[model samples]
Target: MRKNSFAIGCACFLVFALLRYPQAMLEAGAKSVTLWFQQVLPSLFPFMVACGLLLRMGAAEIVGEWLKPLMRPIFGLPGIAAFPFFLGIFSGYPMGAKITASLYEERKITLSQAEHILSFCNNPGPLFLVGTVGAAFFHAPFWGYIFLFCCFLGAIATGMLFRLFYFSKSVNDFIPYQKTPSPSITECLPQTIADSIDTITQIGGYIILFGVAVEAMKQTGIFHFLGNILSFLPFSEEFLCAMSGGILEMTNGTFLLSTAPDNLSFRLTAACMLVAFGGLSILCQTLGVLRNVPIKKSRYIAAKICNSLCSGMIFFAMAPFVEKYAQKTVPTIAFLAETAFTIPIFYIKSSIFFFACAFLFALYQRR
Candidate 1:
C-alpha cells in the first residue's frame, strides 16, 4: 500500500511537470541532464565516501560524546542519538534519516529515540542556507542567518514538544553498542567517496525532475495564478509565491520570494517561514528516508506547522527592524553583520561536516 502510494505521488509529480513545463523537460534533455549530473556528483561523491568512512570508524561515537550534554538538555535525546540528530540538521533531511537507518541496522539506538530525533533532527546546514539560498539566490546574506535562526528555533521547539507530549516508553530493541572495527584511511576515503557518489546518483534524478517541474510551473503561469489568488490576502505576491515554492523546494521557493515585487520585510518573513518548514523538497526527501522506518507523517506535519508558526512570528516581529535598517545600511555593513552572525552558526553547521570527516579519519587511522 505504501509503495503504491509513493509511486502514485511520483507519477503525479511527473505528470504535473510534463504538463506545466513541457519546454523545460525538452531543454533538460541529455546534455543538460549530463551536465547537472557531472556538477553534482564530484562534490557529492566525496562527501558520501567520507560519511561512510566516518561511520565505519566510530566517528559518530566521538561527536556524540561531545554533544551529549548539550543535546540532552535541548531535546532529551539519548547521547548516541545525537549523531543522527546532528547528521539530519547539518547534512540535510534524508541524510539524518540515512544515519538513523544505519544506527538501527547496527543496533546502536532504539526506534523510539530515532522517532524522537526525527521530530527535529532533519534540517540543512547554515552553509546551504547562506551560500546557496542567501548569497546565490536572495543576494542578501543577512537574510540567510535570519532564516537559519528561524529553522533552528523551530526544530528545537518541535523536539521539545515531542518530548513533552509524545514521549515513547518503548525502547529500541537493538543490539548493544560495541566498538566498531575500523579500516585504513586510504581504504576508507575511497569507500566513503564511492558511497557519497552512489547516494547522490540515487537522488539526482529527483532533483532534476523537481527543477524541471519548477521551471514548468513558472512558464505555465501557475505561480502567477497563485499570486493572483494570494492577492486577496493582506500579504504581498512574493510571500504567497514563496510559501508555495518553499513547500515545493524550500531554498528555491525562498529564492523566488526574495525576487518578489514586495518589500524586503515580506521577503524576509517568507524566507524564514520556508526554511522553518524545511520546504516541500526536503519533506519529500525525508519521506523517502522514513519509508523503511516507523515514523508517522502526523508527527512530521506537526513539526512543520510548529516551525511555520514560530518562524512567521519571529519574522513578523523583526519585519519593521529589517525594513528600516536594511535599506539604510550599506551593503558592506550588512555583509559584515552577516559575517558576524554566520560565524557562530557556522560552528554549529561544522558539527556535521566535522563529524563526517572525523568518521572517515577514525576508520583510516584504525586501518
Candidate 2:
C-alpha cells in the first residue's frame, strides 16, 4: 500500500510539473539540466566540505554542550538537540529540519522533542539577512540586522511559549549527552572541507530546482497576481507579499520582501516575521526530514501558530521605536546597534546558521 501511494505521489508530481511548465521542462533538455547542475556545484561544494570539518572537529558537540542549559529552559529540549536547534536559527529553515532528521535517525532525540524543536527551529541565517537581504536587497545593513534581531526574539518567545503549554513534561525525556572525541585541527580541517562539499553537492540539485521554480513563478506573474488579491485584505501589502514568497520559497520570499516598496519599519517588520516563520518551502523540507520520525503535523502547525503570533507581536511593538529612533540615526549608528544585537546570537548555537552547517555535517557523516 505504501509503495503504491509513493508511486502515485511521484506520478502526480511529474504530471503537475509537465502540465504547469511544459516549456521549461521541454527546454530544460540536457544542456539546461547540465547548466543547472554546474551553476549550483561550486557554492554547494564549499558548504559540504565545511560541514564535514565541523563534524570531524566535534564542533557540533562543543556547541551543543554550550547550548544545553539555555535550550533546556526555553524549549524543554536536551543538549544534543541544541546542535540542530542552533543550526536552524543560524543557517535557516531546511537546515534545521535536516539536523532534526539526523538526530532522530541517530536516536539522539525523542519524537516529541523533535516536533517541538521543529516549531521554532526554522529561521533565516545571519548571512542571508546581513549579506543578501540587508546589503544586496535593502541596501541598509542596520535595518537588516534590526529585523533579524526581532525575528530571533520572536522565535525564542514562541519556543518558550510552546514549552510552557504543550511541553510541560520533565526534561528526563531528553537523551543523555554522548561526547564525540574531537579530531586534530590538521586532520579535521581537510575532512570537514571534503564532507561539506559532498553534503552540499547532494542537496545542491534541490536548491537549484527550487531557485528555478521561484524564478519561473516570478516570470509568470504568480506573485503579482496573488499580491493583488491579498492586498485587499486587512494586513499590509508587504505582509501579504512576504507571506506569498514564504509559501513558495523562503530565500526568494525574503529577497522579495527586501525589494518591496514601503517604509523601512513596515518592511523590516514583515521580513522579520517571515524569517521567524521559516516559510512554506522550509516546512516542506522539514516534513521530508521528519518522515521516519513519529512526529505529528498538528503539533508542528500549532507551534508555528505560536511562533507567528509571538513574532507578529514583537514586530508591531518594535516598529514605532525603529521608525522614530533608528531611522533618524546615521546608518553607521544603526548598523552598530544591529550588530550589537546580532553578535551574541552569532555565538549562540541555536540560531539558524549553525543548524544548517551542523545538519549538513551530520548528513555527510552519517554511515
lDDT (tens digit, per residue) of candidate 1 on 1-367: 8869987976786687777666667775453366446545554455555566777788877776655555555566656676776666665545766777666655667667777777777776666666566655665555666666666667777778777754544232323445666777877776566656655655676566666666667666778789898889887776787677678777568667767777767676777777777766567656765666777788777877786777678768865655433322224322113333333444356557855765565455446
The TM-score, computed over Cα atoms with residue i paired to residue i, of candidate 2 is 0.68
lDDT of 2 by residue, 295-365 (tens): 77877877776776677678778667555433222243221123322333432444577557645554444
TM-scores for every candidate against the unseen true structure: 0.75, 0.68
Off by over 4 Å in 1: 1-21, 28-40, 170-177, 180-194, 318-367
For model 1, give the RMSD to the true fold.
Answer: 6.9
Model 2 lDDT at residue 173: 78
Scored by lDDT, model 2 comes in at: 0.61
